[model samples]
Target: MKVYGLTGGIGSGKSTASRMFRELGAEVLDADVIAREVVEPGTPGLAAVAERFPGVLGPDGRLDRTRLGARIFGDPAERAALNGLLHPRIRERFLEQAQALADAGVTRLLYDVPLLIESGLHETMAGVVLVWVPRDVQRERLMHRDGLDAAAAEARLAAQLPLDAKRAHAHWVVDNSGGLESTRAQVRDVWNQLRARD
Candidate 1:
């Protein structure tokens, strides 16, 4: 089985690429989904988070994601603490899901991890597929997508490694600066390449 890592900066359309890959018959293990699953109301992940940051739970006893996000965004120490707690569990879940998929005879698999590069998983992948966009486009999309002002969007972008830096490390680059169909075409080309390599 060929396991590829799909990643991109926020608003660079990694999610769209993931969906296109799914349509192309690849089994995708999305880290964000697994992260949320691991931290559900009764899980140890949530318990730890609640303990670390009190008042992050809602009246229904579930993690208030917005509140927690507000508390950690741009706060390096707090953000690191949260990652220290969640990353290990998320990695474990990814391994479990990948094994199940492999057992079920899945060969072409993609791990859609937003922080693939930051988390140092790129070296572990068969190949890393980076969805690329210009910094201006990324900033525009972030503001439009998340309703953030320029300064706020810039801060979010500053949190991750620059797109140019990540591009240098990618095994495959899918340029997503154009229209949706253009991005889809790039995905199709990469899909063909991946299948051929396997």
Candidate 2:
């Protein structure tokens, strides 16, 4: 199976590219989805998190993700603790899903992970695809998309490896700073190259 790592900065249209890959007949294993799954109510991850970070649960017995994000994003120690707790379980789930897909005869798989570079997961993939945008565009789009101020957007962007740095590490790079049609065209081109094992 060809497992490709797809990553990008926030608001860089990584999700959009992932959907395009699926449309082009690639199985996409999304880390963000797996991360949420591992932390759902009644799960061991949620229980561990609730123990470590009290008051991060909602009245309905579910994890309050926004509150949790606010608590961890500003503190490296807290963020590291959260990642330590969740990343392993998320990896386990990803492996299970990948095995299932491989068993089902899927040849192409894209692992959509936002922090693929920061987490050093690119080494595990057959190739890496970077969906890229300029820092200014990314910050503006993030602020508008997430209802954050400029400073908050900048902080969030600063938390990850820069897009230019990630580009150097990628096997493929898709520029998503333009319109959807352009991005779609780039995705199609990349998909062809991937299928060709380029």
Candidate 3:
């Protein structure tokens, strides 16, 4: 099985690309989904989080991601602390899932991770496919999607490496600045390329 990293900036339509890949019969492990699972209501992950950052849990005893995000958004030390608490657990789950997929004879696995480059997980993949969008487009899309003001959007983007810089690390770049049909065509082309590798 060949595992590839599928990544992009926050508003670069990475999730959309992941859905297209899933539709095309590729197995995808979404980090964000796994992240949520590791911290679900009754889990130790959630307990550790609630211990470290009190009041982050909602009335339902679920991790209030919005509150936690707001707490750590621009604070490096707080963010690092949170990452330290969750990353190891998340990595363990990722390994378990990847091994299960491999055991099941799955090929062409795509790890849909938004912070693939930042976390340096791309080094473990056969290659990386970046969903690209110009910064202006990315900012506009982010503002509209998240209902964030320009400053907030810019702050979020600043936390990650610019999409343009990440291009140097990508084996393939899927430009997502265009419309859905165009993106689908590019995604299909990339799928063909991945299939060809086999």
Candidate 4:
């Protein structure tokens, strides 16, 4: 199986491109989805988190994601500490599910990681497809989607690796400036090229 990574910043349309890949018959493993699942109601990951960040739970005993996010986002050391506790577990879960997909003979898989470049996972892919859009567009989209004013949006963007830096390492680059269907067409072209390399 050929495992490729798809990555971009918060509002670069990476998920939209990934959905296009899925429609093209690729097995898509989303890091954010797995991250949430690992810490859900009954998991050991949840237990560990609750142990570290006490009272971060609802009355029904589920992890309060909003509460935890606010706490961690404000404090960098706290964020790193939580990551230390959670990353290993999330990695293990991702591996198990990815292996299952490989075993099922899904040769071309797209692992959509928002922080792939920041986390240095690009080195782990067979190849990488980076989604890119102009910085102004990115900021606007982020502001609209996140309800962040311009300054706050810029701060959020500053947290991750810059789009240009990620673009430098891509095996393929999908520019999302034009339109949704245009982006989808680019993903199709890239998928054909990636699978053909096998």
Candidate 5:
């Protein structure tokens, strides 16, 4: 089975590409979904989180992600601290799930991981799929979608590897600057080429 790590910067249309991959009949794993799952309600991840950051949990005992995001986003040290605490747990879950899917005979798996470049996880993949858009478009999307001020949105973008760099690193690049239909057509063409392989 080939492990294709699908990655892109924030607002690069990774989410949309992931859905298109699923629609094209590829088994897809989302790192963000797995990250959230590993820390749900009564899990060990939740307990660890509580121990690390007191009162960050909601009254209902769930992690207040919005609060956490606010606390971490602009602060480099805080962001590093959070990543240090979460990356190990998240990586473990990813490995376990990937292996299980391999065991179950999934041949062409797509792991949608936004941190692929920064995390140095590109080496783990058989190939990489990077979704990309123009920098201006990405900034505009993030502002409207996440309601971030220009500076904050720019900071968020700066936190990740540049989209053009990601595209250069990718085995396949899906340019999403055009309309959704154009992007989907490109994705479909790529899927056909991928499916033709072993």
Candidate 6:
């Protein structure tokens, strides 16, 4: 199986592109989904998080994402601490899933991670496909999608490496700033290219 890294900034339509890729028959391992699973109720991941950040779990014994987000936002140390606690568990789950998929004879696998480039995981993939959008479009889409004001949106965008900078690391760039059909067309093209490479 050939594994590719799919990444984009928040609101750059990365999830949309991931769905399209999945629809096209590529196995996708989403880091965000694995991250949530690792911390589910009764898991050691959840227990560690609850111990480190008291009061962040809900009455249902689930992680209160909003509370945790608020706690980590604007606090680099807290964010790093959270990453330290969750990343290893998430990676373990991701590798397990990949092995299962490979055992099932899956060919093209896309590791859909928002931080593939930032975390330096792109080096492990066959190639990286970045969903790209101009900075202004990214900021506007983020504000609209997340119901954030311009300032808040910009602050969130500023937290990550800029989309333009990430383009340098990509083997394929799917521009998703235009209409749905246009995005789909680009995704199809990328998919074909991936298959050809395999």
Find the 10 residues in a row with the least total lDDT in model 1: 189-198
- Candidate number of the best TM-score: 6
Per residue, candidate 4 scores C-alpha lDDT tens digits across 1-198 of: 777889998899988898888888888999889999988899999999999998899899898988898888858898888988888987898889988988987777888888887777889899889999988999999999989999999988887888999988898999999988899889899988987886
lDDT of 6 by residue, 122-154 (tens): 999999999999999999998888999999999
Instruction: Give per-residue lDDT, candidate 4, residue 108.
Output: 76
Residue clash pairs of candidate 3: none
For model 3, give the 10-residue run with minimal summed lDDT. Answer: 106-115
Question: Candidate 1 — which pairs collide?
Answer: none
Flag clash pairs in model 6: none
Residue 84 in model 6: shift from native, Å?
Answer: 0.6
What's model 5's overall lDDT?
0.88
**Number of clashing residue pairs in every model?**
0, 0, 0, 0, 0, 0
Candidate 3 per-residue lDDT, tens place, 1-198, comes to 788999999999999999998899889999999999999989999999999999999999999999999999899999999999999999899889999999998877899988899899999999999999999999999999999999999999999999999999999999999999999999999999998997
Q: List the residue pairs that clash in candidate 5.
A: none
lDDT of 5 by residue, 8-78 (tens): 88998999998998998988899999889988999988888778777789999899998888888778898
Model 6 quality (TM-score): 0.98
Model 1 agreement with the true structure over 146-178: per-residue lDDT tens digits: 999999999999999988899877988999999
Q: After superposition, how far is residue 83 of candidate 6 from its true place, in Å?
A: 0.6
What lDDT does the true structure give each of the candidates? 0.93, 0.94, 0.94, 0.88, 0.88, 0.94
What TM-scores do the predictions have?
A: 0.97, 0.97, 0.97, 0.95, 0.94, 0.98
- Supply the TM-score for candidate 1: 0.97
Q: Looking at model 5, which ten-residue stretch has the lowest summed lDDT?
A: 47-56
lDDT measured at residue 21 in model 6 versus the true structure, 0 to 100: 92
lDDT at position 94, candidate 2: 96
